[model samples]
Target: MRLLLVEDDPMIGEAVLELLRGERYAVDWVRDGDMADTALRSTAYDLVLLDLGLPRRDGLDVLRALRARRDRTPVLIATARDAVAQRVQGLDAGADDYVLKPYALDELLARIRALLRRAAGRAEPVYEHQGVSIDTVTREVRVHGQPVVLSAREWAVLEALLARPGRVLSRAQLEDKLYAWKDGISSNAVEVYIHGLRKKLGNELIQNVRGVGYLVPPA
Candidate 1:
């Protein structure tokens, strides 16, 4: 998944960025609301982690602007603000969820997973089709009841294809999900990862549409 992290505190931003990246998410971090608003306008993200205290513009304004543009991307507000009114206002302004500043990283990850699950219209973390099964939480893949190992990039590609099952995801879309702003992606990076996934998972798992990119046929 690709995520936008809007945090002003260096310690918090650095920690969250590393954590999300380690979880195999493509994360773009901005330290202020202005930059966050620009990113929201320019790119498509799977989710957004936003902090209420920001520079240049208020975080609440950012959220309102995002909603004003009719962007339905999920937003999770993480801030030091703990007032009941603040939490209610954030929800009223269109945040999908909220977490306090000193929250557990494990719980934060859990909330992220839950939001992703809801966005995908799925309740289960394990995704299964035919003989292949993948546990999103465990990062485990099994084929025909046998464990299979996949590289991080390969796993990312497979997960992207599985995210919407029958819907085709263009190479550009997949690339967006696999890389952040600083990462250099090869011209054939998506192809390479897709090839790796096919070889390890199954030849017929990801279907190519010749000109339309790829998809996992509906089960």
Candidate 2:
């Protein structure tokens, strides 16, 4: 999945970025609310980690603008605010979830997964289509009760497809999910990953819509 992380603290931002990357998410990070707002307006993200205290612009204002523009992308507020009123204010301002600073990494990761799953309309952690099963928490894929090994890129492609089963995603969309803002991607990278996934999972698992894009049909 692709994520935008808006944080001003160098230590915190670097730590969170590395953790998200290790979880196989392509992340673009900004240190302030202005850049965060610009990135949100210009790019597509599966989720956002927003901090309330920001330079130039307040994160709450950015959230308000995002919701005003009808951008329903799931947002998790990560800040030092711990009061009940502050938490309520964040949720009232349109954050889907909130995490206090000095939080456990595991708990933060779990909340991220929960929000992503909810946004995808998935009630369960494991996604099953046809005979293939994917454990989102473990990053494991299995076919016909047997485990299947996939490279990180292949996993990213599959995750994007499974996140919205039956919804066709164009190559560009898939590429955005696979790459961060600074990463260089080849023109045919998405196709290559699709081909590899088909080989490992099965050709029928991912279907192409002529000139449009690709999707995984509902099980």
State how far residue 182 of model 2 sits from its true place (Å): 0.8
- lDDT tens per residue, model 1, 27-88: 99999999999999999999999999999999999999999999999999999999999999
Candidate 2's TM-score: 0.98
Clashes (N, CA, C under 3 Å) per candidate:
0, 0
Q: Residue by residue across 1-219, what tens digits does model 2's lDDT show?
A: 999999999999999999999999999999999999999999999999999999999999999999999999999999998899999999999999999999999999999999999999987999888888899999999999999999999999998898788899999989999999899999899999999999999999999999999999876
Rate residue 101 of model 2 by lDDT.
Answer: 91
How does each model score on TM-score? 0.98, 0.98
TM-score, structure 1 vs. true: 0.98
Off-target runs (Cα >4 Å) in candidate 1 are none
- For candidate 1, the per-residue lDDT at 66 reads 98
